[model samples]
Target: MTSDEEAFRRMVRGSEAAFAELFDRHSGAVYRYSWGLAESRDEVADIVQETFLVLWRRRKEIRLAGHSVLPWLLVCCRNTAYNHNRARRRSPAGELTEPKPGTHAWHRRVEQEQAVEELAWVREEIAALPDTERRLCDLCLIEGLSYDEAASALGISPSAARKRIQRARGKLRAAKTANL
Candidate 1:
C-alpha cells in the first residue's frame, strides 16, 4: 500500500487517481469533523467538499503533518467551516443566529475558540524554536512519536530526545505563562 505521503506526492504531480484515493480515505473523517462546527447537515456537506477542493488546489504547497495528511485536512475543514459561518453572519438574510450569551452553545463556542487560539500560539512558539528542537517537538509532541521512534528518526539517542523534549516543554510553559 502506498503511504499517504507517497500518495500525496503523486497527487501533487497531478495524478487524479491519487487525489481521489486520498479523498476516499479521508473525506468521511472530514465530514464528521465538519459536522461538529457546521450549523446543519447541508452546511457540513459544503464544508467537507470545500475542504477537499482546497486540498486539491493547494496540493503542491501542503506539507504533511506526519506520515499522513489527515491532520492538515482537519485544519482545512475547520477553517472552511469558520469562513462559511462568517459569510452567513454577513449575509443580508442573516442565516446564522448568534447563540445567546451564557447559553451552553455560546459557552462551548467560546471554549472552542480559546482552544484554537492556544493551539495557534503553541504552533507559533514551536516555529520560533531552534531548528533541532522544533523538529523534535514536531515528531515527539505533535506527531505523537515515541521517544525512541523520534530519536531514531532524528538520529539522536532516546535519552537525548527526552531531554530536548523536556527543554522544549519548559520553554513552551514559560512562554505561555508570560502571556498569561
Candidate 2:
C-alpha cells in the first residue's frame, strides 16, 4: 500500500489518481468527524465536501503531519463545520411555526430565541473590542486557530496572541455579567 505522505506528494504534483486515492482513504473519517460537529446529515455532507475542496485547493501549501494527511483533513473538516454553523447563526432566523402555547415545543423555541439573542450580544461585544483583539478573537476563538497560527497570521508572538485572546474573553465575560 502506498503511504499517505507519498500519495499526498503525488497529489500535490497534479496527479488526479493520487488525489482520488487520498480522498477514498480519508473521506469516511472526515465524514464521521463532520457528523460530530454538524447538526444535520445534509450539513454534514456539505462540510465534508467543503473539507475536501479545501484540501484540493490548498494541496500545494499543505504538509503532512506525522506522515499522515488525515490530521490536516480533519482540521479542515472542523473549520468548515465551524464556518457553516457560524454563518447559520448570523443569518436571519427562518419563519418558525408557532407551537401550541404551554407545550414543550413552545418552550424549546423560546429558549432557542433567547440563546440567539445572547449570541448576538456576544458578537456585539466582540465587535467592540480593539482592532487587534477583535482579530485575535476571530482567528483564535471563532475560527479555532492555535495561538501560534494566530500569532503568525497577525505578525505577533504566540504569547502576545494568547494574552490578547485572554483579555478579550475577560472583557466579554465582564460585559455579559454587567448586562445581567
Candidate 3:
C-alpha cells in the first residue's frame, strides 16, 4: 500500500484517483466524528461532505508534518462540525429566508420548530434539577467549565462530578425518549 503521504502528494498534483483513495479511507471516520458532535443525520452527512470538499480545496495548501493524514482529516472534521453547529445555532427559526411554507417545506419548518421547543423544554428541565446536580450541570454545561473546575468548585471529586453529570444527562435523555 502506498503511504498516506504519497497519496496526499498525488492528490495535490490533481490525481483524482489519489483523492478517491483518501476519501475511501477517511469518509467513514469523518462521518462518525461529525455525528459524535451532535449533528443530525442529514447534518452529519453535510459536514462530512463539506469536510472533504474543504480538504480537496486545500490540497495544495495543506501541510502534513508526518506520515499520517488521519489527524489532519480529524481536525478538519472537528472544525467543520463546530462551524456547522455554530451557524445552525446562530440562525434562529425566524431568520429563515424561505419564501413560502409549502407542503414539504412547511412540514420541515414545523419539525424544526418542534425541535426548538423540545430544546427549550429540556433546558427548563435542566434548570429544575436538584441542587447539587443542577449546580454540576450549570457549572459544567451551561458555564462551560471543565469537569475538574466544576468539581473543584462543588467540592467533589472529578469522578463524582462525572457521575452526577451522567445522571443528569440520563434524566434529560429519558425525558426526551419518553416524549419521542
Candidate 4:
C-alpha cells in the first residue's frame, strides 16, 4: 500500500485517482465529524465538500506529520463549519433550526467552535516561532517523532532538541497567559 504521503505527492502532481482514493478512505470520517457540528443535513453536506475541496486545493501545503490525515481533516472540517456559521450569521436568517443556548445542541456547537479556535490559535503561535523552532515543532509535535529522532534528523543533540521543544511549550504557556 502506498503511504498517504506518496499518494498526496501524486495528488500534487495532478493524479485524480490518488485524490479520489484519499477521499474514499477519509470522507466518511469527515462527514461524521461535520454532521456532529452541523445542524442541518445540507450544512453537513456542505462542510464535507468544503473540507475535501480544501484538502485538494491545499495539496502542496499539507504536512501530514502523522500516518493518518484524520486530524488535519478534522481541523479542516471545524474551520469549514466555522466559516459556514459565520456566513449564515451575516446573511439573512433563514428558517432554520438552531439550538437554544443552554441546550445539548448548543453545547455541541460551542464545542465545535472551540475546537476550531484552538487549532487556529495553535497554528498562529507556531507560525510566530523562529524558523528553526517551527521546524523542530513540525518534526516533534506534528510529525510524531521522538526528540532523539528529530534531533538526529536536524543534526542536533537529543538534549538540545528536547530543550527546544521545552522552550516551545513555554512559549505556548506564555501566550496562553497573555491571552487570559
User: What TM value does model 2 have?
Assistant: 0.51
Best by lDDT: 1
Reference-based lDDT, each prediction: 0.87, 0.86, 0.83, 0.84
Clashes of 2: 0
Error of 3 at 107 (Å): 19
Pitting candidate 1 against candidate 2, the one with the higher lDDT is 1
TM-score of every model versus the real structure: 0.54, 0.51, 0.51, 0.53
Instruction: List ranges where model 4 is wrong by over 4 Å.
Output: 1-7, 10-95
The whole-model C-alpha lDDT of candidate 2 against the native structure comes to 0.86
Candidate 2: RMSD over Cα atoms? Answer: 14.1
lDDT tens digits, residue span 115-161, model 2: 99998898789889999998887666655678999899899999999
Encode model 3's per-residue lDDT on 1-180: one tens digit a residue. 578999899889876656866887889888778899845465888888888888889999999978878889889988888888888788744543663666788788889999999878977898788889988876766556799899998999999999999999999889879888
* Model 1: pairs clashing at backbone N, Cα or C within 3 Å: none
Of models 1 and 3, which has the larger TM-score?
Answer: 1
On the 0 to 100 scale, the lDDT of residue 174 in model 1 is 96
State the displacement of the C-alpha of residue 11, model 3, in Å, after optimal TM-score superposition. 0.2
Expressed as tens digits, the lDDT of each residue in 1-180 for candidate 4 is 577777788778766656866887889999999988875567998899889999989988889878777789999899899888888778856686889999999999999999999998998999899877777887777656788998998999999888998998899999999998
